[model samples]
Target: MLTALGLLPLALLGGWSLHAAGDYKEREQERWMLDLARALSSAADAELDGTVATLTTLGSTPALQNGDLPALYAAASTLARAQPDWLGVILTDDSGKILFRTMDSYGAPQTAAPADPDSLNQVLSTHQPVAGRIARGPRGRAAFPVRVPITDAKGKLYTLTAVILPDRMVRLIERQQVPTDAIIAIRDGARATVARSRDQKGRVADAPSKSLVELMRAGPEGIGTAVTTEGQQVATAYTTLSRYGWAVIVGRPTDKLRAAAFERMGVYGIGIALSLLGCFLLASLLANRIVRTIEALQQGAAALGSGAPLTLAPSSIIEIENIGKALEQAEHQRNAQERERAQLLDSLNRALASHQTALADAREAGRAKDEFLAVLGHELRNPLSPIVTSLDLMDFRDEPGNRRERGVMRRQVQHLRRLVDDLLDVSRITSGKLQIDATPVNLADVVRHAVTTSSGQQISMSTPAAVWVMGDGSRLTQVLNNLLSNAERFGSSATQVTLTVDATHARLVVSDNGIGMSEELMARVFEPFQQAPQSLARRTGGLGLGLAIVRKIVELHHGEVTVYSAGAGTGSRFEVTLPLSAAPAPEPCAIAAPHVEGLQLLLVDDNVDAAGAGAALLELLGHEVRVAHNAAEALDAVRQKMPQVAILDIGLPDMDGYALAAAIRHQAGDTPLRLVALTGYGQKEDITRAYEADFDLHLTKPATVADLQRATAPLT
Candidate 1:
């Protein structure tokens, strides 16, 4: 019953709102239609003034009087080209024989002129400005003709100038300030558009167009609503062209106006909906309170019938107030039961944390131990890659038992020796004994020597003659050798390794068509023990230490290295930058002058066989040879013979090779003799120790036979 009471008032309010909204909307649309009609009528007046200016200019031009028909034709042509909508312009004698006419009834250029006596008769009889009936124009276009008298300087009328009105005015009415849903036009009393916008089908029917004809006939100050023959209901307004005796009528669709009215009505409907909603809310609230009171009292009665405790509600109606006191007692009992359950859950969480602590500790310890093993493996594996690549090259011998294979094996052994040397280098660097012997050196000479000595990839050098830099010759050569070796080992054999020398630094670029690296690999390629780990790397085997050493040595000389790659299959390029140095001049020293008389040479090694073998090799290069097993014996030989070259081993038993070299240099002041250290300790720091001890040259264990011959050749 309460629900029904609430709904009754809401229904009445909604109906009233809808009716009011509809009435308001109708008034608004009527106002909008009136304003639109006025704006269009005013635009037509401006067009008439523009037509007058066009005609006056053509008649007054001096070029028209000389009987130059082309000049006059050009003037008329200019006006038409400037305004495509222009119907045509005609100049005629007072008798109405056409003098010049350009109105083509068919879509063709005007070539012949024709006169109409009927049009002349009307003009003379009216003795006033006149307009002609709408006629089909070029291309079936429609236009209207307006005629005015042309007079001579003596005030005697000589010609008639008629302008066919352009149709753009009608098109302008249709598009400008006109609504798409509304149809509008400017027309004469006979009802034809001077200009028209075409319909979608390229045809505009006379029926929809007929409303304008009716409005125009009604004369100026006309207004009406009619269903156009085209099946549209529209409102039209008209005003006449006072100067031309033509009427301009504007038609707008009536349904569009009605729709606008309905749109306004919807706004009012919203307000009504809101008012009705407020009434519904008020009624619903009152009904709910009454129904709830009755429900509570009925429940209390049921509890009493069952002999159970009853609850009372605090109702303003007072009948159910005692029910609230009974409910309060029941709620208190429920709260006590909830408290006991929560206590058990909290106790369980505390026990779990204690049980998991030891397991967590054990996992962290295991992770730390694993990281240590990975670093150790990387260090051990770094040296083995270059050796593997060199060894693989050896096994590629085409024939069994060939001496060529022996040479390949020897190269692989040298590769193994280099790997061992790099390991010792890392140790020496860590112990902080790396030293530099700065000298003014010819960098171009060093480049030629390095390129000539490097074995694998195709090496080329383009250096300016006599270019120089400051660096230790042996170490600089070592730096270049390392770079060249890495390029040959990793890049393809056919790759071109180029050495470019400049004023400030030398740039070495080693490029290969072998598999390139992605951005990720290029980033870490020079990092210690990091190489491309793809199948290509397996084919182009390396421990990756060569590039790392190359980078470190270049850095040691204050230069840089940059790598570029075009991604995986494209091939990689490595650039090594080295500082430049100035060339040195020959200096006077204590050692005997260059061989006017043959200079003696001494060589030493802890391995007696290596000592004899090296001396024999030196002699083959045309150098006098003296062999010794240790540096002490080599020094004693140096004192006895004062040899021009002394080659000593670093690991000699009696004393270190570095100490012995120092003693020989001290005994022979400013010795011109080249003190070459031949040793197994070929690490970078160990070589630095040799230079510091005044040795002029440093050669590693198992140095290539060609390398030994070249070192001795300088002394000879």
Candidate 2:
């Protein structure tokens, strides 16, 4: 082991050097492809620029201006043959009438113009060179129309059409020194190939490969690896021609790059293999010496292990001498080990006792806290029923003053309800009992509902169509309401709140120009009971659970919320992101609207005021209403006449609402009664219990008249 360790670093260094060499070669190959693409692009641009410039000078020739038609035709024909860049030249007047042509039957010059006279009109109108679409040029091959408009000494406009044949382009490409395996293609504005250095058989005007076309469409210039037309993987670079909207693509086969890399690896691999050979030689020599010493040590250890005498052949090595001495003191070491074992056992026992005590205390504290919250939530919500019912009674009276007071009262009740709901949610969440109903819901309607419940805030909404997400609509509305309310209180106004939805994400951004949070406050903004510092005038004392509850609810729906602030008094922005649903929320199955006439109904609640007020409200709605204050009373009333609907409160003097629901179901036997549960205990577990007891629906206490009406009217 020691000999191996001494030689290990040499092997590692060699391996690392080989890797570095291979990476360097790979980078060189990539850079080579990019450089080749740039060079070919520059060459193509120069060829086009050179041809256009030559034609512009020719367009100003004096032969054409002197009205010497024969002389001009001879000069143009000589120019086309001498330059090899122009397939032919057609001289056209401003009216697009072709008068002279230079190419005929077998690409030889001719006096008659071609039948098609369509290429000169654009240059005549714009007075600028326009790259015409690719077409069959004079040499019976694909060509580009390079048109230029010029005025002679008489100031009469004349258009000169110079067709650039692929033959000339082939000459330009031949001048470029590219690799044999590489492909360089130039495409005209219409994506038809002007020249391809490595073209396979047939088809002069074939379009470029799909990969090259896709890249050119996406961006001007970039490097990538894609399959070529021949299905070989290659590294490529592409750029659009600057003068015209053509594309130049350069590609090198990936196999070539790999071959270059492998060659580099071979060079480095030879050095590593030699170094490894030397390392193994050194290790073998050292291992032989170490093996002899180990054999002597092993024999001595066997004698000592068998309880024989601690005698052996002595060595000059100091390490072996120390081992021999330790073997002689083996009896003493055993006694010490036994003492340590006893002490370790004692220590472990004490630690175990302490851990058990702490765990027990922690569990007890949790139980007490949970019990306290449950009692507090129930007691607080019990008194709210009468207040909400009284507000409905004031609406019936219809006095202007009473309506104003009732509105104020309703707002306060909602505030109280939110407070109670927050406390219960926090407790339920920590205990892992909170479950959210996930269904596709439209975010716009949810935000609008939340806005209507607000008081002193300005809210402007911008929504694009319908953005849907999978979550409980009511809970999502609560999240929006919390954020909006906070902005109204601590922020400038609701107008700064903006909600937007993209293809796959919904964002709710609320900004405040009011007093902002400090860095320290922002750090714990989502911690329960964390409140910002407040002055007397700005004191809006809350339980500080709003943001905390918002975070928990959003997380349950697979979303997150982030808050940003510039510091205290500089304002802040809160943004929430949730996954978008593919389809809009499914609308509730429509039930035929219930008849306005009276129907049999039972109102059951332990609170006399709640039962009496609900019964009065039902009687006014043209229903034959029966009232009860307990489970026994409600069952007795139902026995007299089976009502069409039974509204049973979960909390009762004799038994809970679930037991009563079960009893009513059993007694009714074959008869169907629409059982609706109304209670202050509106936790998830309570709802589950109600359903288990055969209740068709569950509604929390202080439900609106509309809610009760919907419950009482059975769906037909």
Winning model by TM-score: 2
What would you estimate as the lDDT of candidate 2?
Answer: 0.76
**Candidate 1 error regions (>4 Å):** 1-403, 428-449, 458-480, 491-508, 534-539, 577-608, 615-677, 682-700, 703-716
Give per-candidate clash totals: 17, 1
Q: Could you give candidate 1's per-residue lDDT for residues 98-177 as a string of tens digits?
A: 65656543234544543334445666667554555555544564555555555544444434345454455655565665
Error of 1 at 308 (Å): 82
What C-alpha root-mean-square deviation, in Å, does candidate 1 show against the real structure?
Answer: 37.5
| lDDT of candidate model 1 versus the reference | 0.62
Error of 2 at 374 (Å): 3.5
Model 1, TM vs. native: 0.35
Runs of candidate 2 exceeding 4 Å displacement? 1-367, 535-539, 584-592
